[model samples]
Target: MSSPSTPAGDLAFVVRTIARTAVDNEGAFGDLDAVAGDGDFGYSLARGFEIVLADWDTLDPGTPDEFLKKVALVISKRVGGTSGPLWGTAFLRAAGAVKDRTELDAADAVAMLRAAAEGIKARGKSDLGDKTLLDALIPMTDALEQRLAEGGPGAGPAELAALAASTARTSADATTSMQARRGRQSYTGERSIGSPDPGAVAVAVMAERVAAEWDVRD
Candidate 1:
């Protein structure tokens, strides 16, 4: 089960890699929403990532599930917004999806992403058309599953990660035309237009970092 394919190492590596990338881009996301949003998203995410890493080395979780659960605690505590709980739930659910896996394959990767989408939807009570992270996540999940079902074309974690990143990027970019139907921007209605949602942008960051860190290709 567990082997080079699984790539076992410190949980901190996962947290730090994703957090650092998200931290760098979080501020830009806030910049896009400075006019309407509280503009704290960038700092809040960075803080959460920073805090999540503090205990990374101590957690020798046997599976992605355990690691995600720990990250959920930190994400909820570190970030003080709707995003905190939403993302925390997504991560926790994803963790649960792979709890028993000693090694993760392309299919396993897709399962994690699908679980993440369902988690966010269940927790946030948001749907696909309503234009939240779900907008980005659902399509990305679909793409990954589709790719995998096609016999995967010499796929591995690296290829799967790349596909996820591409899917996330396209979804985030597509959000420009979407109206905010949930979260902090929901209250704004049409005012939410033009500016992309912070959560959607963060999804791209999260996907990219996950791919880069987990990519097994030399």
Candidate 2:
């Protein structure tokens, strides 16, 4: 089957893969989030994505930015906690990157990711190695940029998605061994060693889901 690039394709993948992510992460995100903040993160996220997928068609956000803004607003209203705002911001920024696109190319995807990373950093003021979503965002953006540069902007979404997944996973997994120096988890100090940050987990889940949905598995 041809891979997804248009709004319809993005819609289909998002609906199915988001549910898969919630199933995969289960309580892990909630449990860790409870340590320093409200415990509703995973639940809120799952609920929000469920809602987003269900009304995804009706959303008809017009442009990518509008689509993301709609999701951000919907998620913020329907779900409670920092997760709603954080995820909303990420989507909003990515959406902004492709406001003019009906279908995102490899370069367009890279722009989306770079915008996403910048949004997270701007909102959180955290840098790479802080063990936040930037952990995944930085690597993922770099991977996309490298792939696009080497293979040209015409590189397929599946291949780009594959590289993005690999990079995100690497960043997410590496956090398990490192100490979190950012966000609420920073207070945990060495205690945060064994558990991955919920935000990082969320990033990994989103990237992996998008990769699979787009038929990009490495």
What is the C-alpha local distance difference test score of each model?
Answer: 0.74, 0.71
Instruction: Judge candidate 2 at residue 17 and give its lDDT.
Output: 70
lDDT of 1 by residue, 80-129 (tens): 77778887887788888888776656576678779988988988999887
Cα error, candidate 2, residue 34 (Å): 4.8
> How far is 157's C-alpha from truth in model 1 (Å)?
2.1
lDDT of 2 by residue, 79-194 (tens): 66666666677778887888766654557667877987888888777888887878888888997898777875546766676777888888888887768787667777887777
Off by over 4 Å in 1: 1-15, 210-218
Residue 100's C-alpha lDDT in candidate 1? Answer: 73
